[model samples]
Target: MTQKKDTILSREIGKLGGFGARLVAGLLPKNIFELTIETHSPPETALEKAFTILSTEGKVIEDRRIDPNKPAVCAIVGSGLGNLNPALVEVYVVSTKENITKLVIIGTAKEGLIKQYAGEKAARRIADLLTQVLP
Candidate 1:
């Protein structure tokens, strides 16, 4: 008998690096509770890049497996993100079977780890960067 590859609902959070962070920074939302950054790239390829980028800056806090039935799932404790005051952000990658990928970044002006980050400026920066990063 051969071992089967575990279906990775969500890749390890530590996988993201600077490049992935840069990709995320490019797609985050500024003035909303949540925003989705969409891309044509396949989920596997996009996630691989994101994981590499995240791993470079922050350590992984949570790595939850996603449900394949759902078109989108959340990537929690992603790197050192999703907070304000201290200015951290929680990054989420949403993918569809159609091959449309999105980066769901949530944050606010509050402090502490659970608080949200990302202002209008940050969202704009993320959007601008996305245009450059995604193919």
Candidate 2:
């Protein structure tokens, strides 16, 4: 009987710990950030440049056109300090006007108590790279 009671108590404690962890995660802020810039290159050219630039930073997980008449979107998983600090990046290339392309980069990372700014940092780095290379 004592053994059964101990097992039950341990299970309940495990459940409570899981609940607390989930509660804390729900209360934490989402680690998402975005940066936008305009370049003189056309939409297709800008997107190609973005892919080339971001591929150097990390693996380009996806590259596709959402719609025939809409902007193109690219997804990248940026390499960070290690495997635990990967940043997810989404890049959208839009044609705002003739010969003007707007690139929007959104980056997000797993929310943690110590590294909340990882996503913003990654996004800024990617934007800077694009700005320097895109023309």
Most lDDT-accurate candidate: 2
Please give each candidate's TM-score.
0.43, 0.68
Model 1 stretches astray by more than 4 angstroms: 1-33, 65-88, 95-97, 112-131
TM-score of 2: 0.68
lDDT minimum window of 10 residues, candidate 2:
1-10
lDDT per residue as tens, model 2, 37-109: 9999877777787778777877666666445555554444443455334566677875568768788888765
- CA lDDT, every prediction? 0.39, 0.63
Candidate 2 clash pair list = none
Best by TM-score: 2
Off by over 4 Å in 2: 1-29, 65-69, 79-84
